[model samples]
Target: MTSTRTRLTPEQRRGQLLDLGVRLLATRPLDELSIDVLAEEAGISRGLLYHYFGNKHAFHEAVVRHAADDLIAQTAPPASGPPLERLLTSVTAYVDYVIANREGYLSLVRAAAGGNDRLREIYEEARAVLTDRVFREDPEGHILLDTPAARLLVRGWSALTEELVLTWADDPAGVTREELLDLIAGSLPAVAALAR
Candidate 1:
């Protein structure tokens, strides 16, 4: 096996393209995206775009991976504490991320639901990472006894949170972000108490 040297600073170029793709994700749905459109936006040719990613599916996969990796890194479980508190910290970080990067992340979620199969697969992997973290932070929560139970819990909680976030994004005036976080965190204690 021979290791080929990158000819045109491929690392930097790939970063630029991913960044470009992420921006496009926010503005336009992923299904409608084309390598030509991405190339025009980045002021690069389709050949150059192909060099970085073989197709739109590959490009979107990279974008989801990049975003998910960053989110996972940033929202890592808190150091040493009541699992509940650590869980809350992780959750708060999630809400904050949604508030700050609403368009980009939500688009990734939407794309995963019904976009390129490659990208959808990558996005599901990312979602699992996040859902797993939620479970980790709540090890003693009701879902611990079974994997399917845990998945169900995650789905319910995440759907509610997602709706709350969409509402927040739509009208920041009506609901306080802090209040939402409190309500979510409160559920943990309630659930944990019953489990005990």
Candidate 2:
């Protein structure tokens, strides 16, 4: 009997490793992820993993970056819709995503708070991307995040949304998903208005 494997380009192989890392991350904390374990999971050697990511910290950074990007991509708002409708749709998608990836989401948050500077940078960058999208997609000219104060308030709203969704996912506390979504989606304008 002969064993054979399909050959993949370096890019494809790296992407495959990152995808695997993200999947594993969904179920475990980042600190628990080891290069040796990941290499074994991929049927590769640890040296090969090093070739792709350089070192353990680099590998973790790459994995976190991929996860953050995936989260942002997953919750992207529809390209066409009423402004409020799009906001609600985006918020719904975000909530659904966090709920589905609850453990992974928590791990990411913990990793950031655990004093890993690179992970913290990746996490903050992800939040900034989401915040900028909200401003860029404001078709109604309502969320005028023009001034620094306005932008600060909108960022605060983003933080609130994240905290609310994470807490609400653990226990709804009698708040239906729809109501939670409404509160998150509807409050942005008011939150932004505070800077007026």
Candidate 3:
């Protein structure tokens, strides 16, 4: 079997691996993203897969980090305003990014939820930042009960965002961005009052 030890340019190899990993998630569940299949598809042998990622879980962790960086980079809001304003900007930015990376993000979601506890832990940690931002923006908002609550809510929102975006991914006509944002925004009042 082909491995990903050094099949292409390093960046290309990495891209190929990540592409394989993320795309595999769509056809199969995250836990089902076999390293053998991944190596085969990427034109690398299983050994290279190991050489590149150490193992499937390590590869997954790398994917998670890459995806999170993309998210954090894409959604980082203006830092000179109320937390809520910053949050709104960040969320909208995030929605746009999610719309852009639905497949990859959803893949990670499935993998994180259906695979390792470590994966789940990492996802929750990233998710908590969003909750913290939300709470900071609109203190005592409806969300923010605990880390789990934040993960659940953020994941819920992400799932919704993915589903809606996926449905509209190729279509020209669908829920406008404003409408989607409004739906998310509408829940703010309750979230703001969550712990009250």
- The model with the greatest TM-score is 2
User: Looking at model 1, which ten-residue stretch has the lowest summed lDDT?
Assistant: 137-146
Order of candidates by TM-score, top first? 2, 1, 3
Identify the superior model by TM-score, candidate 2 or candidate 3: 2
Q: Which prediction has the highest lDDT against the true structure?
A: 2
Residue-wise C-alpha lDDT for candidate 3, range 98-178, written one tens digit per residue? 666666667666656675777777676766665555544334442444455555565566556546655665562767887
Candidate 1, residues 49-113, lDDT tens digits: the string is: 88888876687677777777767777787666776677778878888777666677776777667
Candidate 3: C-alpha RMSD after superposition? 6.6
Which run of 10 residues does model 3 get worst, by summed lDDT?
137-146
Worst 10 residues of 2 by lDDT: 137-146
Best first by lDDT, ranked = 2, 1, 3
Question: Model 2 over residues 83-166: C-alpha lDDT tens digits?
Answer: 677788888989988887777788888887888888998999998888777677544644565678877887899889999999
Enumerate clash totals for all models, in the order shown.
0, 0, 13
Model 3 vs. true fold: TM: 0.62
